[model samples]
Target: MEFCDECGSMMKAGEGEDHWVCDSCGYEKGRDPEAEEAMETTQGQEVSEIIDTSDVEDKGLPTTTVHCPECGNDRAYWYMQQIRSADESETRFFVCTECEHKWREDDH
Candidate 1:
């Protein structure tokens, strides 16, 4: 009888199937052919779509009067983005254009 690597539980052989199921932890093992094919296709597409960022524009949305904290330069650009949190609250990051420094800002 095979054993589970995670919880040290006994693993049962799946009848007429390629998977091995863990009786104690309910963990499933073995690859699904359809799911594997889908993942491969997604990875191939992502590899093809990867672009060089050096030649691309920053394209960050515009904001008002973002000053650099280090150099005190007021001619910096700003961008607003949604950051995920543990409590599911959104946080914003303000990036300075001149110095490329990032700072967290509260929603106003």
Candidate 2:
């Protein structure tokens, strides 16, 4: 991506053009988007140990409908945790009823 040197704003290319024009300061620069194409990168990531409770026979936890990423179960058990700052909302936890796959989502 090209940026303006005068105003430090992002620069854009015009139709049938070979230069980048600054939207803020009108500064122009040469651009070759094909040579600057982004390449995807991947690396081996370690899986951390997680506590799963799908096999435990407990009926006290609240149950909800959620698609399980592991076993494709539509029903799951849920809980909430305040795993953030005091001002932030709680994180909702879910465990698949069939496969016990655990996941969480933060309250917006």
Candidate 3:
């Protein structure tokens, strides 16, 4: 997760994974062994229980009585996302249960 000092962009591993290089500004930095050990990610360090939901349709999402313009379905699964600024309201997304149509509603 090294960042480029020149352009403030994320850097990637260079040739042979010996150094980090910024693609945007062509900046390179040698990898430190001590820093690499400290920066080791904790991903996959522990195994968590995985629930299989292959038989579920909506993946346990809540449903609402939203109108689907594509298939005229009255029932749809809804979720909210912060697509706009933090001060503004979150955008409401709807997926029709019958026809799987997707749509979004914003507080304009």
Candidate 4:
């Protein structure tokens, strides 16, 4: 792509189409009747920005005095989950160690 006024580097096309070679100082030069067009890249524009926070700080998950049909609270914060069948039995789930209130006990 033409650029080697005796070693400024970057030419390369010679073997006589009228000469050009200069891959760093083999300096030939003389082939430019227009022919240099290859450099293209395009793809930029994406932004989704989303933020939601309920701020939880519970870090304690195994307690159980159970009984908090919504704030009746007598301790609670358990877990069991297998959600049915593996020969059924494991779905206890609760959570109210003072009203963080969440429940789930069904197996009938």
> Which has the greatest TM-score?
2
Candidate 1 regions with alpha-carbon error over 4 angstroms: 1-57, 106-108
Q: How badly does each model clash, as a count of residue pairs?
A: 0, 0, 0, 0
lDDT by residue (22-77, candidate 1, tens digit) is 98888878746676456533467546643332312266446557666777767544
Worst 10 residues of 1 by lDDT: 48-57
Error of 3 at 101 (Å): 0.6
The digit string of per-residue lDDT tens for model 2 on 1-108 reads: 667888988888865678888878778878776777664444432123234464544657888887887788899888876666779897788877787777885321
Task: Output the TM-score of candidate 3.
Answer: 0.45
Better of 2 and 3 by lDDT: 3
Off by over 4 Å in 3: 1-58, 106-108
TM-score, structure 4 vs. true? 0.21
For model 4, what is the alpha-carbon lDDT of residue 97? 65
Superposed by TM-score, candidate 4 places the C-alpha of residue 74 at a distance from the truth, in angstroms, of 12
Q: What range of 10 consecutive residues in model 2 has the weakest lDDT sum?
A: 42-51
Summarize candidate 3's per-residue lDDT along 21-92 as a digit string, tens digits: 999999999888787787756646233322233333638878899788899989988777665577989778
What RMSD does each model have against the real structure? 9.6, 9.0, 9.3, 20.0
lDDT of each: 0.59, 0.72, 0.76, 0.63
Candidate order by TM-score, decreasing, is 2, 3, 1, 4
lDDT of 3: 0.76
